[model samples]
Target chain A: MPAICFIFLPIKYYYVRTHDEGVAVNKLNKFPKMLTRMRDGFLLNIGFAVLSIAIFLVIWYGLSIFLDTAYLPTPVEVWDALVDSFNTPDPSLGVTMWDSIMASLKRFVIGFVLALAIAVPIGLIMGFSKFAGMIGKPIVEVFRPIPPIAWVPFLFVVTGMIWGPILAIFIGVLFPVLSNVIFGVKSVEPQLIDAARTQGASKSDLFAKVVFPYTIPYMMTGIRIGLGIGWMCIVAAEMIGARGGGVGIYILTQANIGRYDYMFAGMVVIAALGLLTVEAASYVERRVSKWMGA
Target chain B: MNRSVLITIIVAVLLIGAGGAYVLLSSDDDGENKTYDVRVGYLAGDLHQVARVVASDDDVNGGESLFKENGLNISTPFAAGYANGGSVMDAFAADDIDIGFLGSPPAILKSLNLKIDIIIVAMVNSEGSSVVVKDGIDNFTDLKGKTIATPGVSSIQHLFLLELAAANGMNVKLDGTDGDDDTVFYVQVAPKDMQAAMDTNQVQAAIAWEPYGSQMILSGAGELLLWSGDVWPDHPCCVIAVSRSFAETNPDTVEMFLKAFIQANEMIDGAFDAGSGETYDRIITLATEFSGTNETVVLSSMEHMDLDYQIGDNFETYLEDYTQSYIDLGLIPGSKLADRDYANVTEYVEDLVQVQYLEAVD
Candidate 1:
């Protein structure tokens, strides 16, 4: 676990040390040295990631052998199932793994983006305007704690199958992002607001220059948390009957038919996909933070 | 933030916490579990497994449930029943039940897949399920490029649809979210949700066990395309499966359970023959209550379903054919027979379906 976290360790240092010399000749002369540092860091990250996964696989293999049951399939068995999924229609789901992933990915991305668009602005308004808070807080609080899976039947009935799973993801992601952004806006320093006001800034200017930038980090935190929750929602959401095959359905179908190896293979794809999304969010955060010099 | 208000809030929170815990624990009652000598599981709202409801009812057997008359205590852990055969098999694997009534395909699928030590003790019913389609969709080819709902791949309904699609030489697969490619796609929906799925146009057709099919027809949601019986006469649908270890440990108890089950089948047969009399009305009422459908749907369902416990040579052949179909569809690998120390599908089926307890009865 710690080895995998090391991947992010060199990222900040690599960027923080880059000198912006405003087109100076010395910056050009030092480019090769910087490239060497980047290459070293990249290799270290890759090495640590490989080591972490290797340790995980060893532990899993040992446990499977120790248990000696068909329930816990070996990594080799899972790997074969995973490879077969791409080439053939899944034994249970009747679609290639690639097809499943694409369908699920489409739902996830659509749901995630929708959550961000709707939630962030509402959170900002509710936090900033007391009247808005009076109205919005009650509604948000009422719906926030309801589990996303509980809405499977209703969503399917109302939104139909194609949009049902997507809405489930939307609901799962919405609350966390909304709550965090609200907290972020409210946590903005009063002193900073006063300074902006004294500097003859308009309401819009004050928000864009100070409030928005300060809230970025907190909003990102909410997004990271929301994305994790969103992935957890996929299984239950898609279980409502995704219009297309999905990892959640694949896992369920395999388990239903007593194909543990294939079930495990579905789980692996979901875990890998989840990790990729989280990493992508982090990378975006890193770049945004650097550009803003936060 | 007043001191008295704070105390009141804290006390209220504790009260709610205690209430929630009590509800949770009471729902999964150990006392009730201990009271039953044999715990049974069955599919929810499935009209095919009426023998179980019939066997457990006191009204039919002189004010005592048939199990009590046979000197055994039988109870269902889930009052509402499982949603499908797959879930029933899950309950057995989890040791939540000693016996289960579910589709034979799932009994075969999960037993070999998880290596769950269970034996097929008896057949529950033969042909009760139906393939229902929206109006104007008359045949197999018309079903192409449309969404159809199934309980899940673990269901015999799914197997039926697969076979139908193959016979027509048309392609069928899980819903790819894009179904314009001249391939019929199926989606997994609980049988209870079949009507809702159809209403939303998410599925143009759904294959489900009666009285769900009959219920939909009565409700005017869809029309029946084919009764399961129309396709395969005297087919094996749901069966009674017992945990092998449980049966071995309590052979007499298992026989007692089967005895009551066989008696229940006889009672059902008599009720069907009674022809609008009191016994027939009683059976309809019991089935309606058990399956949460109207008496109309139950009566309609009875006409299509054949309640039988026979696992004879013909039935054995049908089970073999079902196993072969699964292998051909890549649902179950041929290697699993060897994995379980069976030489082939025939051996696997023979080992799986044990009629010893049924024979021991009476």
Candidate 2:
């Protein structure tokens, strides 16, 4: 995928031809009006998102007030809790919400990078070789259906650390990348390979120049999808040992202690974190695809 | 143009998200675990009668007046009830109780996890615990290579068996294996299916506290192996633990609680004359209030009267023994605390108990 990304990306740029080259001239001609239009669009989205948040908070508050039993503390009570949590001079141990977030992120990144490292090469090998495909296909099929959580104990027993949960994320992500790499490799036009051969390119060169280029986008797509799934698996992964202070642990601990407020808080934090991750991933996808002219 | 700026933005967002998550995950709450207007957990069979009595009693500080002060609708006591000590322990861990009654084993296990701060306000009863074994197994060692059923891995019954095994040089593995030839099979099974487990020869013996133990004995299915209290005399069977901060912030309220409990204990022990009209009414009311037995049956249930309501001074001995058993079982770290620390449990207990409360009531 990396070779293909290096190869086809140039081909994409050759056709791209600087679509935005005339932007400065166009901006000068209608700069004020165009800027205002873009500004309006941004403001409109901001308003809609704000309204959506306000509506959610109102509904949540109403439900909480109507169910003012301790089992269902009102949003006001939760808000007060949130405020009280911050008001203390030094946020005590376990009160470190930032620490939990960083821990989860660190685990997620390590698992993600490790998955990519293992999956991409295996995927490339399986895509190009019949023997690799035949041997790997059955194994992938058998393990893919076994949920990431099933690997948690295996990971724990092996690493004797919190890495078990992280490994679960890696395993979950690997299958998607494997399947996508195979699809991407197969999708490379055979004529391009033949052309490369006719042009005195070596077998390796043909593969490097023609096949690799077509597969890069597919591998990227797989990565995006796999990472989404990996994040979901992280919570199950963090359940293995005592040092497990991930977002999932946070939620479960609150649920166990019947602290619904903290549980809700943890859940909300996860959602927000997920949104931020997706946004960053989307930005990278857009930038990469644009640079590749794909 | 500015990659560092983008990186900074990403890092900042991540830190904020991470910070929120850490606070959500790590917030240590040792106090204010009271999540309900009235979080009340007790024996399932006893709740209805107790609710009626509390609904009627005006003298008890947080009984009837508690409901009134909280403006709780008195249509029915919304108290949740469970049949087993394990479930109550789970509920307690979940903060599903402002106050609840839990068996000694669950309470002891809970004490290991420092944040819980469960204080035994009073001893509920002692003789209700019994272990039953197969009819042919005349002695404890006779049931080698056979499985014994327990409700949970850490129930009082379960721990009693563990304590017994440790004393007798047996390894209580999860699968009920003793490395040597002599083995007593011990495994956890759901409480409801215990009788069936026994009947079908799935389990060779069962260690259960009443009313399951008493009920099993009555059925003539098994012979008694040992009463758990006899395993460790005056072992503080079932206990009533209130939140430490609840006791601290509301000391007078706690004292009032002790008064009510002591009065009930005195009445149940028959120290007060039930023949007197006032005493008889209170007795009938209490029998109706706490146990939910019919006034006649509840009064009769107290016939084998040994209400040892005193909280023993041998706190260190129980803690050391209990913590050591957990350590030996590999349930907790052996080096978690020292002898002095166990002796001065008052670090946690002082926040929960005002011995003066019990003494004053006495």
Q: What does fnat come to for each candidate?
A: 0.87, 0.00
Error of 1 at A124 (Å): 1.5
Every model's TM-score: 0.85, 0.45
lDDT of each: 0.85, 0.59
Model 2, B148: alpha-carbon shift in Å?
A: 29
Q: Which stretches of candidate 1 lie over 4 Å from their true place?
A: A1-56, A290-294, B1-36, B177-182, B275-282
lDDT by residue (tens digit), candidate 2, B226-263: 77766677665666666665666665555555555555
Q: Write the per-residue lDDT of candidate 1 for residues B160-229, one digit (tens) a residue.
A: 9988887888777777655455678999998888998887777999999888888888888898899988
For model 2, the superposed segments whose C-alpha errors exceed 4 Å read: A1-47, A71-95, A242-244, B1-362
